[model samples]
Target chain A: EERPPPRGLTAPTVAAGAIAKKWLAEHFGVKIRGYMSQLGPIVIPFQSWDEVENNPFYAPNADVVPELEAYMDALRKDGDSIGARIEVIAENVPAGLGEPIYARIDAEIAYAMMGLNAVKGVEIGAGFESVSQRGSEHGDALTPDGFESNHAGGILGGISTGQNIEVSLAIKPTSSIRIKRPSINQAGEPVEVQTLGRHDPCVGIRATPIAESLLAIVIMDQLLRQRAQCGSDWLETKEQE
Target chain B: EERPPPRGLTAPTVAAGAIAKKWLAEHFGVKIRGYMSQLGPIVIPFQSWDEVENNPFYAPNADVVPELEAYMDALRKDGDSIGARIEVIAENVPAGLGEPIYARIDAEIAYAMMGLNAVKGVEIGAGFESVSQRGSEHGDALTPDGFESNHAGGILGGISTGQNIEVSLAIKPTSSIRIKRPSINQAGEPVEVQTLGRHDPCVGIRATPIAESLLAIVIMDQLLRQRAQCGSDWLETKEQE
Candidate 1:
């Protein structure tokens, strides 16, 4: 959604990603879900977000809420912070989306994820774990039916493999902590710094929705790039293939 | 270097990067150099390509030619291939070039280098080596004179620090080797393939100039981006600061 600037004003502000996601979901049957994969040392086993609205934790597992709360309580008591991991999956993504080399879907995903506040690392599917795997153990087997696995994370050689696109992010602890620590000044002098402001002990609590939105934006961008490079019938041709 | 497509053609063909580099050099005095850092196991000690055209090796060291020839001869004899490493540096790059998050200068460099043929990995400054380094060891110290070091590779927080921007690439062996290899055809049938066309045993030999062009293109791109986002006088303001 966009609105013209008021009289004498120069520009209009818009939530472009949110608007685009809404438009895409309305036009295409794309479905995306982002959820906390881990909080501090706790691994959350939420497979879906069906009950996210019903719980303050925004996860399916209500049982894990106590553990998460306790963890947050301990962090607050110690005037400390913790990190988190989040996962996002996009389903019904067009198979022919993404470009080679510079604009690979996975590369774009990493760029987008790392751009997010506090994100330090990003991975696609097996990611770093695949480094230890033999080819036999890592390469997904393609069958006449469909892909037998998604170890390539829905991408191969910088192109989409027509599977569900998956991504994970490692977010660093919130930097504006209550704990006093060593720091620096603009003059390159050593200083002690302690952030004193209303801050979330764990910013990851709000990242799930934001991550979903970001993934949507990246997919939309890739879709636009593919359309520009291959024309509108590209999807139709890919479907026939 | 752009030519209007003859007569009935609607578009023009152009060597855009070459033209851009020439224009930037003429207008802004940006200087760039790219050279082979290593070929296979041979580490090239060439600091510059001053005598690149005087020798068939395109390197400053004439003595290394025999070793390079020997390595290529051995590869040709075995019908095998080997990888290469290249380094590109841009000097007089204005400080404050690049964008945050998705379009970090280093990220853009990685994206551009990865887009190049056969490039498997990219590193900025100390790059992967920093993985093993502590913060004190990896971070470049800022001083009144300038950065005490450049371990950040001329960039900090996604912006240029006006230092010489350095980038390195790990290029895989050229895939079109003479050796017969097992592969699959479009019909999903097993096949043995051997390339027949005249091919360079080491593609990196020709990559130096191209990589220079690529880095120039990336810098020019970031310059344009900075201008668009921060206004045309952004560089002047940054220099004032």
Candidate 2:
């Protein structure tokens, strides 16, 4: 018998929403607030992916705290998924901390964001929208009053322009579902399984703070590297003899 | 007969200086600057050690554009050598780009320096000298205006503290000598051969710019990454509204 190629089928959003609502009422209502209150805003500290995979619980999602637990529970009961937006803001960055040829800043950032669990895509300040604007319109104009705007996202020549940088990520829906699916089991045997577990319908809810933590570690590593060379500019100051 | 390990012997500074001076006049002085200037500083961008073996010119001592005619003339003369000190300086850098962590900026800088060919050691912001200072004296105190002092070398917690980064290196004398020496050839046959080509008596003379170029790259990378995660902290109230 000939097998059909993979078909393009979208997940049933309404059905998923109803299931989510039931799951939230049955398991999440009481626990969500407690967990949220205990953790509040979360920050992942590990830089390497090995460290993160070794202990996923160490960096829990910030939105899962008490302040937002009720809403999350309600969301679960409604069978509708909610999205989380996190901003990893940093200050006091030094200039000249990136490689030119292959290890450019943009390349590293993109890799880091993609590494997050549910991050579908990343944008560095008005990213895709820039394509619609003219060069003069999109270019971050230099001005005596500082940059006219932040279209360049605080980077020039792949180096820090001493301005605040901004990035946003769009997370996708979680893959796990309670509904039955045709899938190959561990032995490559055909099997029918309905996933049953405590999980977010949208995994992106946990990705926000994790992105912030990785950025911190990368920045710290690069700063030390910069200081190792040419950190000094003035020496023989005319020896005021 | 079993050969005994060589005994440690100290040569007189005068003798060392004389040998160094003679070598500098005979070999390095002939065209060291010409080689370095043409190459435009010494940082080698390579993926791995295998790539390095594939390309010998990557070694700090290897010259890209050799003054062949002048070098041959010097090689024809009796044994001679030379040495030089190349200094690099980066000016107008902001403070507070690094943190004290597994990825300290100073440590990374040292690693880069050691990564270079024949580089013995690296130092940062009066490096080892700070070890002798008291806490009150060594610490960079913050003033309402700025810093009253900067003994910490513009760093704290492996992160930059918004100050000028400073670093230096000690370049070693080149190992290849014109005088005959015992060595094993590719066939594992022991033989004596005077190096026929002209090489830098000391490689440090061309190190300054290479170090600067790498430092620039690392700093720029970190700054951009930091901005992406944390630069949005300063978002205006209008956006919040």
The second chain of candidate 2 has a TM-score of: 0.57
Candidate 2 lDDT by residue in tens digits, A20-118: 334333431211110000111223232443332232232234332344556446546644443333334344344455664334454455445434433
> What are the Cα lDDT values of the candidates?
0.65, 0.41
- Global local distance difference test of model 2: 0.41
Pairs that collide, model 1: none
Model 1 TM-score on a 0 to 1 scale: 0.59
Worst 10 residues of 1 chain B by lDDT: B5-14
For candidate 1, the docking band is incorrect
* Deviation from native of the Cα of residue B156 in model 1, angstroms: 1.8
Give candidate 2 regions above 4 Å deviation. Answer: A1-71, A78-85, A186-190, A232-241, B1-241
TM-score of chain A of each: 0.85, 0.60
Q: Write the per-residue lDDT of candidate 1 for residues B26-117, one digit (tens) a residue.
A: 65677877777677778778754675566555666666878878877887876666667777888778887776655777666655564554
